[model samples]
Target: MNPLLAGDRDVVISAATASGKTEAAFLPICSRLAEEPAEGIGVLYISPLKALITDQHRRLESLCEHVGLQITPWHGDVPKSLKTKLRRRPRGILLITPESLESLLIHQMGWLKTAFAPLRYIVIDEFHAFIGSERGCQLLSLLTRLGFLLDKEVPRVALSATLGDLVMVGKCLRPAEAGCEPAVIESAALKSSLKIQLRGYLIPDRPHDEDDNPVDTVQNQIVADLFSILRGKSHLVFANSRRWTEYFAAELADRCAVHALPNEFFPHHGNLAKELREQLEARLLEGRLPTTAVCTMTLELGIDIGSVDSVAQVAAPHSVASLRQRLGRSGRRGEAAVLRLFIKEQEVTADSGAADRLRFHTMRCAALISLLLKKWYEPPLTGLNHFSTLVHQVLAVIGQYGGARADQLHRLLCARGPFQETEPAAFAALLRSMGEDELISQTHDGQLVLGVKGENLVGHYSFFSVFKTPEEYRLEAGGKVLGTVPVDGPLLVDQIIIFAGKRWRIESVDDEKKVITLTKAKGGSPPLFLGDPLLVHDRVRQEMFALFESGECPVYFDAVARDHFEEAVSGFREWELADRPWLVSGANLWVFPWLGDRVVNALAILVTEQGFQAGNDDGILEVRNCSEAAFKQAIKTHLAGPRLTKKDLAARLEGSPIEKYDKWVPKSLRQQSQSGHFFDLEGAYQWLERKTDFLR
Candidate 1:
């Protein structure tokens, strides 16, 4: 082993997925443990997902036995007896999730020193997954607190497969003043010999009348075609949502039955029981049966499911980064990976014909694939302010320590966190807002503690996470509950809802606990497009503008996709869609300057800030009666300004609705907490810069 292992610098092992990144990270730590096996926990391994933690534990256990060290996994599912064993004889690595780590700090405050006294290194697996998220921010705060508690600098080692922005990840893991040196070990460039294939479909024409059955007819045809390709292959079919996963699974199975094929397929998503998910994973790994698992993003991560033969994506994956991860899952055994994209085509019979719709759909798929093939991945991080997460973390700190001084809390939060640049006045304003909200109570001794309301919040397991989840109503039938459906609005009696892969007719609703009783129904209802907001990086918008301007086509576009792209480009040039920001299509007017989602959001914010009535749906930013000249000027001015700093971008994200931690946190902390979420002002500026000339 290298003698430089005693150094205090962070190590980054950037290898491809399934390439022993886990072993590479753990080997050095285990080597140190061999030299000096500390009495207490010697290493901390943090993972983004609970499933990953469980998998890591098994892997670590075998290695620990080889090295004569004890390894333990501590998550919600881990038994209490195991935890007691660790507390009694703390040794080796302690695997945990961010929320579980927070629980330890909150519940086991007294054990902080003894348990972590021997801590030499903190290993964050899949560090890229945590970047630009509230969970990332929360983990950063926890790490900062742990550092403060240890009163010593801890070396952080981060392992990731696909990281588009390494600098951002470094900044997030270690602040500038911490004097931490990050070493990047990029092995992906060496190992990658990836081959990608893009598939295309034609949007079929439908009848002009409402009585036409082409929608279902077209869906059946698509499913049939997909089943033919999927059969006899051990593949993972990815759908964007759970309901779609179910629909596709059922459709594929039904198609199989009609074709007299064995019904060995399964559906795996978050809504399924843990047992079922594990069963599917085991079957896939065994490779005994010809089974295909239709799943959501649950299977997208680094969970080992053996080597999948191929991957079929249902629609356009939201971004190229996600597409790369999914595609990378296959082709691991020195063979080229195969990916088939099935785009569901729908035609607007009123004005836009099937050709136009198909061309547009084909263009989008081509654009995403082209971007990926050209080594460009979407870095569209969320732009919303995370002040709420900060609020929860502050409250969590006060709860853990019983009572903490105001200055200490502020300094600890802002000094080391991603919010290091946040001004004292803004932080004070947030604190005052929390004080006004009665979430924090100040004692006569001038210390801060959780108020009654805040105490109530921290009392629940749900308060541990900062991610926003809508208030959902549990769907039950004959005393056995199915799953949950979001309670966005009041549900009337007998309203049909589809959840957990089944359609249900509402029998009754208990509004108090937000539970809805239901019975099984025959026909499937339209799937709920749970308005998952998409962030568009300024880079993508600039690329889109480039796509419009450049005469040469992107090399990543496949032959069929390129033909469609050429058609779209021809149409855009003929209609002058690039120069004219407004084009009325069907019922809505599309304002196109080739900007991605973030700039569109900035434009929306600019409109809202400028006293103009505007709305957004899907990727379209809508405004009514606003002069074209004013919109052009706004774009030009924003483009001409100096690149937006992180703080300025975060400021733009202020005033977004608090999705998580229901009003218990102080407003100021909430704002500070939301800072780390993907509010890239520079990206926004770049996007606007590309569109300024077109706007004029």
Candidate 2:
């Protein structure tokens, strides 16, 4: 606070939940602002979600009351009248999101320049949420642009509960030379006890037949367990996907209704209405109904859902960092942190693949939980090139001043901002590409301005976001809007869909109005929501192997899970996986690198380049028309040569749109950027080199 009050250095507070990180940052800010009040906005607090801003606004009101300062929440949900008032007479702190800030800079730069003239500090809450994402890059550029406008550096403060890589986060908060090294305030380790359990279930595969019932035995078991464990407790059940969240919540509600109990289970995700989501939050906080929210990552952040008794996960988390944060939400008010992990896998058959036989889901969940106990988490890696964000900033800059020279745009966006990796030649080429697409046009005065197409884009409210979101259609039942779901194809009138924790049969569909009328159905499968496959870490895979090698089971497993574990061990021994890493399927060969997705992906590329048809089946690298000896020779040769480049592998993939403006980017640059962000080339290479050593 002293250093921050002096305006000499930035600060980063990495502390546990409910540890007063917010107060530590704002105490100095409020004190300084109280001593010398400003006529305009003094502190800019940026959060990743609007709900977080709303929560913080309520908390800060009382803190700022005595200081004679005000804190205003600004986002799309904020009323226009309130925004107009703030524009006319701005004061104190301004809490906003990155997209809102982008819009403000583009559409209200003149107002913002004057309103934020006395800005002294910038606070980024949930700092872990922004790292390694395009949103983070945009925020960094936005902060730099703001400083450029004010002609002075504004000190920064970052707060997070689960920050794994301090060096990278620090660099993100205060880039080199822009500000002094941040003052890190890392809190002591948590002393509270933690109780964790890994519960596993086996679901048998049955042929799909329309005449058969739609009920699933695995889902039934999960819902039954939830009904028994969380009957009257305030808890949270986190699913990996929204479809599952809706399904599980609806299933639990059905179970409760069977016994004539109140509906205490709710589904929360991004598709739900603001009113509905708020209702759920309020009910959970009230502690009257013994509510439990079966949700996705929407509730993982700090939204003040009150003290939860336990946190249950449907499967292995994408990373240990996320699991730790979810665990932090519980164990409040001097209670032990309680976590229950439920891993469900298909029952293995004679023809089942190695992954299914070994029970990948159970192994992965066990490994992640074990690693968490050791305080080992996935570290932050270098991020994407963010060319899409650069294009966004270009249009934003053009909109800000109406027109600007290409050199000015490059200097402001690339040379000085987070897009420093972009070179001058690439910038020129990108401008040319945009001109060809009529996104930007050159004026007779040698300035660039938004063209007709670009005007239509910049005119739309959604243009402020660099991330791509699909157009959604509203779902209504019994004249009540349940929620909205993103549609990728045509919708039929009789199609059965699951949403808002219930099954619905489509009654009518209106393409023009983007609405679907539905009637309640008995049961149905959850809708498919496609996303990038979760990448497993190499260390996690290694840990899975180690767990199998050991003759002991974790003490936290229940009786059912222990039985499943014994079965998995028996099957593992029968397969003799410890004696060999390669399995021959006729003329083809499958190599178990015992590595992660990235290394396997790299290996697939190397095999393909060597004239072998290669693809990844589960965790193994399968090569067509290749023997074990040939595959080994190719890998050894590649390891002895020069390192692989992003272009070498990215070229193998089809040219799919990976970012918002990827279609606008040149084909070569798009692939290059995607590879740099998505593929772990260096990690893959090092992993293979070690394998080569083992082979020798």
- Which candidate has the highest TM-score of all? 2
Counted clashes in each candidate structure: 9, 0
Where is the poorest 10-residue window by lDDT in model 1? 523-532
lDDT string for model 2 (13-55, tens) is: 9887767888988998899999999999999999999988998
lDDT of 1 by residue, 308-334 (tens): 888888776667777777887788888
In candidate 1, clashing pairs total 9
lDDT of each: 0.67, 0.78
lDDT score at residue 592, model 1, on the 0-100 scale: 57
- Per-prediction TM-score, please? 0.81, 0.87
Candidate 1 global CA lDDT score: 0.67
